[model samples]
Target: MPEAKETVLEIDLGALAHNYRYLRAKIDDGVKFLSVVKAFAYGNDSVIIARKLEELGTDYFAVAYVEEGIHLRKNGITKPILVLHPQFTHFEDIIEHCLEPNLYSEKILRSFVETAEAKNQKNYPVHIKLNTGLNRLGFDHPEIGTVKEIISSTSSLKIASVFSHLAASEDWKERDFTVGQIDLFRKMTWELIADLDYEPILHICNTSGVINYPKSAFSMVRSGIGLYGYGNDKNIDPELRPISTLKTIISQIRSLDKGDTVGYNRAFKVEKPTRIATLPLGHADGINRIYGKGKAGVFINGQYAPIAGNVCMDIIMVDVTNISCEEGDEVIVFGGPQHPVKFAEAGGTISYELITGIQRRVSRLVIPE
Candidate 1:
């Protein structure tokens, strides 16, 4: 809310809107977009993301848990929400909140049907997740008979959508396997309800699938990171601005001698007399200590500055000696033009991890255009 502050996470709603609109424009008319809002919209506040997506006319919202769906429903979100990993124990709460469940295995399928029938809920919307090589969750294609059994026996649960997840849509080396997976899904769905009249919406595309192979963009595309701004494949368009920005200020300025050592285990031994800045942010706020040890850089007065020494739980050291920076100077921890932080290269992890790993400790400040 304040103009400038220490240790803040800035979210650009405009960038979010742009990404949503861009991805939406890419898909065909009949193909709907179900933006994933799980993990607090990848640690950027789900309520805000869900509301924004709804305003952007997103087809649906997907989360990994029932609690997440409840959060959106409580926040006045009446859009179709799919819980990818709905627990059997919370079946009652899910029904109470009118949140749909993705029944993956036989046990979950039977459990959901029984619960819905007992509650006298007819045509209760549900999704059937098939394990199309992901092997994480979802019933295997061979188990289509079980889905048929559930459908034939129960009138309570309705198969609103039958979907699968792509394990490696981004890797071209896995293209053969991805193609096989897609084929398997088609064969399984067709054979599962050959005689039965099952007209559930068919979808099996994640962000990468939506971008690379729009052919599989079936009924809906469940996108998470793309809507958050960084589509793992950066080649999409530079105009898709990263919605999140990490910022902090210099807590202290220490003038180090040429041979001065800094931080735990004396990790940073200065080669030059440097003016190092101690930032008011560190591992505790999701800037992992590994991010230190000369791995990343930050922006100081629109110039680049290298991080010095090991990052601590509450403080990070930046070598701002070349920038003519003074005490209490504003520090931009990447996400900007001068020294943009490449999440993959800097974190040695994927953009998904970098964005989702942002701890709850950091306060999110949303700025809508």
Candidate 2:
């Protein structure tokens, strides 16, 4: 275990396990669980996170693209990897790497079937995405006939699972919509099952869906943000522990007199003798530029050091005028005493964006459980 002396992301596998168990407890014992490790496990090292989840008995893992799954496979991940939005060009790679393709449209379905047939694959596993309401991807309920036709026409493909995404499972106001989505999913899945005479694993719930609609857990559920320790609901947030801490060491602390300007464009003007601490990271490291101009603060010496002026590509200055801090002091941009959700809210964004936006250049240290 090494201290974060520079800009680093400290990932706590202990807290990740706690979140996994916590979410798992919400569903039935027999239900399967899929942990999403896409976007580098939401910017926390995909291979490491998947390994930890695999150790905890995660039934499946999902990534947004084929390369991510291939990366996991290359790193010794043997569990089923679902490419949620795979491209037709990568169908060969998907097969060669044993990564499951999510057939969301007729074109993808037919194309993947052809690729599998060419590769001499038999009963190759594939997940079907249904467009219940999100409308982003997946085939519409009416397209089930086409979906069935495509599958029946090819012996090379097998339906591993049928799933959909909830539009707004976290908001109480959208509860009715979420329920409608769930009901539609149930109706579509059973209808498809009736025609096929065999039931593949059925799932539609995400993190919030698992919490708000446990009864609709189906055969399996997907946990994305929740596994990273965010419930996405205020009431349930207290139970989950944040797993990542973003820390950076102050490069220098400079004194500024009244009327002195700080940072680019003179965005922050000192009213009195102020101490400005410059950090070695900024928007390039995923601290969004929107967080500047006093909107977000970093934790230092048990105090808040407000951001001063505009965020730079590789630097940011924070006003630590009133705090007792020196050069090389550890600053917590997010996590530990401060949560990323707070920073997200301050920046008018979401935690998913804030966390996943973290650049790969930053070191990710896994904290022992």
TM-score of each: 0.95, 0.98
Summarize candidate 1's per-residue lDDT along 69-112 as a digit string, tens digits: 99999999989999999988999999999999999899988888
Native-referenced Cα lDDT, model 1: 0.83
Question: Per-prediction RMSD in angstroms?
Answer: 1.8, 1.1
Q: Which stretches of candidate 2 lie over 4 Å from their true place?
A: 1-3
* Residues 6-77 of candidate 2: C-alpha lDDT, one tens digit per residue: 899999999999999999999998999999999999999999999999999999999999999999999999
Per-residue lDDT, model 2, residue 184, is: 96
Candidate 2 contains a number of clashing pairs equal to 0
Model 1 ranges with Cα > 4 A deviation: 1-3, 237-239, 338-341
